[model samples]
Target chain A: MYRYDEHDQRMLDERVRQYRGQTERFLRGELSEAEFRALRLRNGLYVQRLAPMLRIAIPYGMLASRQLRQLAHIARHFDKGYAHFTTRQNVQFNWPRLEEVPDILAELASVQMHSIQTSGNCIRNTTADQFSGVAPDEVEDARPYCELIRQWSTFHPEFNYLPRKFKIAVCGSVADRAVVRVHDIGLVIVRDAGGATGFEVIVGGGLGRTPMIGTTIREFLPAPELLGYLEAILRVYNQFGRRDHLFKSRIKILVKALGADEFRARVEREWETTRRTVPPLTAAQIERARSYFTAPPYEDIDAAACAGALAAARATSRAFDRWLQRNVGAHRVPGYAIVTLSLKRTGIAPGDVTDRQLELVADLADAYSFGEVRVTHEQNLVLADVPQPRLFELWEAVRAAGLATPNIGMLTDIICCPGGDLCSLANAKSIPVAEAIQRRFDDLDYLHDLGDIDLNISGCMNACGHHHVAQIGILGVDKKGEEFYQISLGGNQGTDAALGTILGPSFAQEDMPEVIGRILDLYVAERHGDESFLETYRRIGIEPFRKAVYGASH
Target chain B: MALLIRHGDIVADDWVRLDAEFDTAAPLPPGKLLVPLCLWNARRAELVARDQPVGIWLASSEHPEAIVDALEDIALVAIDFPVFSDGRGYSYARVLRDTWGFAGELRAIGDVQRDQIFLMKRCGFDSFQIRADRDPTDALAGLEEFSLVYQSATVDPLPPLLQREVRRGA
Candidate 1:
C-alpha cells in the first residue's frame, strides 16, 4: 500500500477543517441547502431516504490492517455498526448523522484516508484491478500508476466541477477484473513491440441510463504523458459537455453526440497545447511509487511438500476441497495463493460487513496474508498473498465467521447495490431482490453446476450495481407506483463487454426466483459440453432465454 | 453594493458591468466598462475606439477564442459562472492565461462565493466579483484555503510531484 507522507496528511487535515466549517455554517442557517449540498457531496456525504450516508474512499481498494481496524472503529462508533462495500470498491456507512460526518472524515484522515471526490461532479476515486501487483497474468503492477493518478486527481482545481461525475478505471492484468470498458476513462496497461509499457486509453465508456462501451481514443499513450492526456480530455469535456439537461451530461453522451473521431481530434488538439503547459511525470516519481508496491517478503517453502499437505487436507475434508476450488485463486508466487473472503453470505445484504466482521478481516489479514487487504469490484475482500500451507486454518477461522460462502463467481455471489431501502435515488429496493435470489440458489452443487454467472441487480437505471454488464441483469423499474424487475440477458463485463437486452415485461418481486429458475433451467438444457452460462447464452442468444422467461406467443 | 476582490484585497471597483445588450438608441456609460461578449462582437470597433478601457464578460458556455484576438485592447477578462457549479470558466481562465497569454486582470464574476476563490485563483483569476449578498472580507480568507495544490495550474505550472521534490531539495 502507498503510505501517505506529511504533505498528504496535511491536505487531509485541512480538508476536514474546511468541511467542519461548512457543516457548521449550514447548521447555523448561514448556508442554504443547495449551497451546502455541493460541498457535502464533494466530501462524499449523501442525504439518503432514511439518513445521511457517508462514503469513505478506499483508494484503489487497498487497505492496511490498521486502516481496516480504524474503519471498524468508525462503523461501531459513528455508524450503525455495519458498512456496505460498493461496486466501485468504496465503502458506505448508511446511518451517520450529518453533523458527525466531519468527525468521521477526521477519523479517516488519521488513517491516511479521506473521501475527497468520492462523489459530486468531479474526477472520482480512480479504481484499479484488485489483483494488480499479485496477479499471475499481469504485464505490470497497476498500483503505482493508480497511486500517481490518485494524487493527481485529488483536489484537482481545474476539474472540480465537471459537467457530471466521472469514473476512471485501470487494469493491468490479462483479465479485466476492474470492468475497464464501462468507465468514463479506462486505462489498460499494454506493452509495445519494443517492450515498453504504456496504456490503451479508452474514453467515454459508462453504464447508466445510456450504457456504452468506451471507444479507444488513443491506441497507445506513453506512460509519461498520462496526466497530460487526462487533463486534455477533461479540459475538452469541461468546456463543451452539455449542461442543459442532467441526463445528457456524462462524457459518454458528449462522445456519442459528436462521434468518436471528432472527439479524438478535439482532444488531440487540446493535448497539443495543454501538454506543453504541464510538466511530465518524472522517472524518480514513478520509481518512488513502484517501491511502495513491491512484493512483500515471502517464506521459501518446498512446493511439493506444501502440495502434499494441501492434498491431504482436501482429501480429509470435502468442505475444504469445495472452498479451495471456489474461493482460492492461483497466485504468481510458488507457495502463495490468493484468498477471497466472501461478503456474499446468504441472508445478509450482498456487500454488508458487520463491524465484528471488519475486525475479523483485519485480524485475518495480519495472520494469513501480509497486513494488507484488497477490496474487489465484485464486493469481496482478498488476501492476495496467503501461503498455501495456511489455507486450511484460515478457512476454518473464516468459516466460523460465516464469510466462507464459497461462491466467488457462482450465481449466489450477486453484485448488488444499496437500493431504495437506503438510497433516495433508487426507484425500488434491491437488497430484498438480491436476498430472494440468494435464497433460491442456495444449493452448492446446483450453483457450481450453473457455473460462473455474473448476476447483477440495480435499483434503477443509474446502474450503480453495473446491471448493464452482467450475464443476468435485474434492473428495478417503477411501473405505475409498483416495483417491478426488468430482467436482461447476455450482458458481460469482461474484455468483450456488451449490454444486456431486455427480456419482455418485468415480473413482480415475488416471481423473481421463479423467473431466474426458468432462465437457468433453459440454460442447463441448452448448454453444450463444458459451456458456462455466458457461453451457452451467447451460443444460443437471448431469443431462447426470452422465450423461456416470457413465453413465445408475442 | 457588490464587493470586488482584486489581488487579495477588497478595493473600490470602477469597472461597470453591462449585462444588457448594446442599445444604439442610448449613449454608452462613462469610466471603464465590461460589456457582454455578444455586445463586444457586435460593436468591436466602436468599443476599441472609445476612451474608456473596455473588458468582455463571457457566460459559462462561452469559450476564450472569441476574445483571443481582442486581448490587445482589453485590460480585463471577466468569466461568468451563472451558478457556482457551472465550471467552464475555470478552463476558460486557463486558456486565456496559458494558451493565448492574456497578461491583464482576469476576473471571475457571477455566483463567485467564498468557497470558490482558491480554485479561481489557481485558474488565473486575480479578481473576484463576489456574490452581492456575501461579505468580501470573509471571502478573502478563501485564498488561503490550502497552502498547497496537487496539480499544475496557472498559479504554479510545475507538476505537483516535481514541486514536492523541489520543495524537499530546497
Candidate 2:
C-alpha cells in the first residue's frame, strides 16, 4: 500500500478544512442549493432519496488494515452501522448527516483516505486490477502507474470539471479483471519486443445509457509519457465534448460523434504540443511509486507440504472444497493464494458490510495477508497473499464471520447497486431483485454445475452495477410508475468486450426470479459438456434463450 | 460596482464587456474595451487600429485558436463559463496561455465564483470576473486554499515530485 507523505497528508487536511467551510456556508444559507450541490458532489457527498451518501475512495481498491478499521469507525459513529461497496471498488455510507460529513472526512483524512473525486462530473478515482501484483498472468504490476495517475488526477486544476464524470482503469494481467474496455480510458501495461513496459491505450469505453467498448486510440504509449498523453486526451474532451444534453456529455458521445480516427488525430495534435509543456513523468518518480508495491516477505514453506495439508483439509469437508474451488485464485508466488471474501451472501444487499464485518476483514488481513486487502470491481474484498496452508483456517474464520459463501462466479453472486431503495437517480429498487434471484439459486451443487456466470443488476441506465457487461444482465426500468426488469444476455467484460442484447419486454418485479430461472434452465438444457453460460450463449445466440423465456408464440 | 480580482486583490474593473447586441456599427467604447469574438472577427482591422487596449472574450463553445495569430495585438483574452459547471473555459485558459503563449492578462469571465477561482488561477487566469452577486473579497481566500499542488500547472511548471525532491534536498 502507498503510504501518505507529509505533502499528501497536508493536502488532505486542507481539503477537509475547505469542505468544512463549504458545508458551513451552505448551512448558513449563504450558498444556494444548486451551488452547494456541485461542491458537495465533487467531495463525494450525494443527497440520496432518504439521506446523504458519502462515497469514500479506496484508491485502486487497496486498503491497509488500519484504514479499514478507520472506515469501520466512521460507519459506527457517523453513518448507519453498515457500508455498501460500490461496483467501482469504492465504499459508500448511505445514512450520513450532511452537517456531520466534514467530521467524517476529517476522520478519514487521519487514515490517509478521503472521498475526493469519488463522484461528480470530474475525473474520478482511477481503478486498476485488484489482483495486479499477485496475478500469475501479469506482465507488470500496474499499481505504480495507477498511483501516479491517482495523484495527477486528484485536484487536477484543469480537469476537475469535465463534460461528464471520467473513469480510467488500468490492467496488467492477461485476463481483464478491472474491465478495462468499459472505462473512459483503459491502460494495459504491456512489454514490447524490446522488453520495455508501455501501455496500450484504449479510450471512450463506458457503460451507461450508451454502452461502448473503448476504441484503441494509441497502440503503444511509453510509460514515461502517460500523464502527458492523458492530459492531451482530457484537454480535447474538456474543450469539445458535448455539454448540451446531460446524457450526451460523456467523452464516448464525442468520440462517436467525431469518429475514432478524427478524435485520435485531434488528440495526437494536442499531445504533440502539450507533451513538451506538461511536466514529464520521470522514471525516478515511477520507481518511487513501485517501491511502495513491492512484494511482501514470504516464508519459504515447502510447496509439497502446503499442498498436502490443503488436500487433506479439502478431502475432509465438501464445503471447504467448494469454497476453495470457487473463492480461491492462483497467486504468482508459489504456496500462496488469492482469497476473495464473498459479500454476495443471500438475505443481504450485495456488497453491504456491517461494521463488525469490516473489522473482521481488517483483522483477517492483518493475520493472513500482509496487513492489507484489495476490493474487486465486483464488490468483493481480496486477501491477495494468503498462504495455501492457511486456507482452512482462513475459511473457518470467514465462515464464522458469515463471509464465506461458495458462490464466487455463480448466479447467486450478483453484482448490484444501491438503487431506488437509496439512490434518487434510480428508477426502481435493485436490491430486492438481487435478493430474490439469490434465493432462487441457493443450491450450491446446482450452481456449480451451471458453471461460471456474471449476473449483474442495475436500477437504471447509469449502469452502476455494470449490468451491461455481465453474462446475465437484469436492468430495472420504470414503466408508468411500475417497477419492471428487462433481461439481457451475452454481455462480457474480458478483452473481447460486448454489450448484452435485450431479450424481450420487461417483466414485473415479482416475475424476476422465474424469468431468470427460465433463462438459466434454457442454458442448462442446451449447454454442451460443461460449457459456461457465456460460452453457450455465444455459441447458440440469444434466440434460444429469448424464445425459451418469452415462449414460442412470439 | 463590478469587481475584478487581479493579483490576489479586488480592484476596479476597467475593461468594458460589450453586450451581444452592442452596436458594432457605432463608435467603439472608450478605454479598454473587451469585444466579443464575433465582433473582433468582423472588425479586426478597426479594433487593432485603435490606440487603447483591445481584448476579446469567447463563449464556452468558442476556441482560443481563433485569436492564435492575433496574440501580439491582444493584451487580454477572457473565456466565458456560461455556467460554472460548464468547464470549457478551464481548458481554453490553458490553450491561450501555454499553447498560444499569450503573455498579457488571462481572465475568466461569466459564472466565475469563489470555489472555482483557485483552479482558474492555476489554469493561468490572472484576473477573474466573479459573478455579479458574489463578493469578490471573500473569493480571494480561495487562491490560498492550498499552498501545494500535486501536478504542475501554468503557475508552477515544475512537477510536484521534482519540487518535493528539491525541498527534501534543501
Candidate 3:
C-alpha cells in the first residue's frame, strides 16, 4: 500500500478542519438545510431513516492493515458495530450523529483516508480490479494510474460541480473483473504493437435509469497522454452535458443525443489542441508514483507445500474442499494462493462487515498475508499473497471469525445496495429482499450446483447497486409507498456486455423468492453439463425463465 | 449596463478575439486585440507576430501552453473566469506568472465572484472585472473568507510545512 507523505497528510488534516467548521455552522442553524445538504453529502454524510450514515472512501479498494484497524475502531466507537462495503469499493456506516462526523473524519485522516467526493455530483472514487498487481494475466499494476487519477480529480476546480456524478474504472487484466464496460470512463490497459503499454479508452458507459456500454473513443492512447486526453473528454462533457433534468444529466445521455461520431469528433478536436499544449508527464513523476506500488519481497518456497494444501482440503472437510476449489486462486509466485473472503453468507446482508470482523480481517492481513487487503467491486474482501501451507490454518481462523464462507460464485452470493432503508432516494428496502432470497436458498450444495449466477438488486432507479449488469437483476419500485419488486434476466458484466431484459410486470414482495426459485429451476432443467447460468440463459433466452416464473402450474 | 459577450460577439477592445470568422492573413491593427485562447495554433502564429499585443484575454477553457510562446511579447494577460465557480483560471494564472516568467498585469474578467477574489489574488491575478449585478464590496469580501490557506500558491511559494515552521519560529 502507498504511504501518505507530509503534503498528503496536511491536505487531509486541513480538509477535516474545514469540514468540522462546516458541520458546526450547520448544527448552529447558521447554514440552511438545503445548503448543508450539499456540503454534508460531499463529506459522505447522509441523513437516513434511522440515523445519519457516513461513507468512507477505500480508493481503488486497496487498504493497509493499519487503515483497516482504524476503520474497525470507528465502527466500534461511532457506528452500530458494523459497516457495509459498497459496490464502488467504499464502506458505509448506517448510524452516526451529524455532530460526531468531524470526529469520524479526524480518525479517518489519521490513516490517510477521507470521505471527500464519496457522494454528490462530483468525480467519484476511481475503481479498478481487486487482483490488480497479483493477477498472472495482468499487463501492469494499474494502481499507480488509479492513484494519479484520484489526485487529479480530488477537488478539481472545473469538474467539482458536474451535471451528475461520474465514475471511472481501469482494468489491466484480460478478464475484466472491474466491470470496465459499465463505467462512465473505462480504460483497458493494453500493449501496442511495439510492446509499449498504454490505454484503450472507452467513454460514456454507465447504469442508472438508462444503461449503456461505453464506446471506444480513442485506441492506444500513449501513457503520457492519458491525463491530457482525459482533460479533453471532461472539458467537452462539462461544456455540453445536460443539466436541466437530473435523470438525464449523465454524460451517456449527451453522447447518445450527439451520436458517437459527433461526440468522438468534438473530443478529437479538443484533444488535438490540448495534447501538446498540456503539461507533459515527466518520467520522474511516473517513477515517484510507481515506486509506491513495487512488488512485495517474497521468499522462494517449495511448490510441494501446495500439494499438501490440496491433500488437507480433501482429507476431512467437504466445506473446505469446496472453498479451496472456488475461492482460492493461483498466485504469480509459487507456494502462495490469493484468498477471497466471501461476504455472501446465506440469510445475512451481502457486504455488511461488523466492527469486530473488520478488526479480525485487519489482524489476518497483518499475520498471514503482506499486511495488505483489497475490497472488490463485488463487495467482498481479498487477502492477497497468502502462502499455500497456511491455507487450512487461515481457513480455520476465518471460519471462526465468520469471514470464511465457501460461496464465492454461488447463487446465494448477491451484490446489493442500501436501498430505501438507508438512502433517501430509494423507493424500497433492498436489505430484506436480499435476505429473503438468501434464506430461501440456504442450501449451499444447491447454490453450488446452480453455479456462477450473479444476482444483483437496486432499491431505486439510480442503480447504485449495479443491478442492471447482474445475470439475475431485481429492482425495487414503490406504488404509493408500498414496496413491489421487479425482476430482469440475462444481464451480464463481462467483456461481452449486455443489459438484461425485464421479465414482466412487478411482483409483490412475498413472491420474489419464489420467482427466483422458478427461474433457477428453469436453468437447472435447460442447462447443458458445464454451462453456467448466464450461458444457459443466453442460449435459451429469457422465454424459458419467464415461462417457469410466470407460466403457473409449476 | 454590463455587456455580455456571447460565443460569436465582435469586439473593438485593444485585444482582438479570433473566432471561426477570423482571417489569419489580415494586417496588424493599430493597438492590441484580445484573442480567444484557441488562436495560438500554427495557422495564426504569423498573424500573432504581426499584431503583437499589449495583452490577450485567455479563456479558462483554453490550454495554458497555447499562449506560452507569446509570453515575452504580451504585456497584460487577461483570463476569463467564465463562471464564478470555474477554477481553471487559477491554475492558468499561476503557470503564467510563476512557470512561464510572465511579468505582465494579470486581470480576471467575467463571472468573477466575491468568494473567489482571495484565491484569484493569491494565484497572481491583480485586476478584476466585477459582474454588474453583484456588489463589488461584497465580492471583495471573498478575499477574506479564510483566515489562512494550508497549501502554498504563487503568492506564498513555501508549502504548508515550511510555512508552519517559519510561523513557529516567529
Backbone clashes under 3 angstroms, per model: 0, 0, 10
Question: DockQ score of candidate 1?
Answer: 0.52
**Root-mean-square deviation of each candidate, in angstroms?**
1.7, 1.6, 7.6
lDDT of 3 by residue, A186-248 (tens): 999999999987999999899999999999887898887877688678767776777668889
- Candidates 1 and 2 compared: the better one by DockQ is 2
TM-score, model 1, chain B versus true chain B: 0.90
Model 1 pairs whose backbones collide:
none
Give me the displacement of residue A355 in model 1, in angstroms: 0.7
TM-score of chain B of 2: 0.92
The most accurate candidate by DockQ is 2
Ranking by DockQ: 2, 1, 3
TM-scores of all candidate predictions against the true structure: 0.98, 0.98, 0.82
- A269 in model 2: Cα distance from truth in Å? 0.7
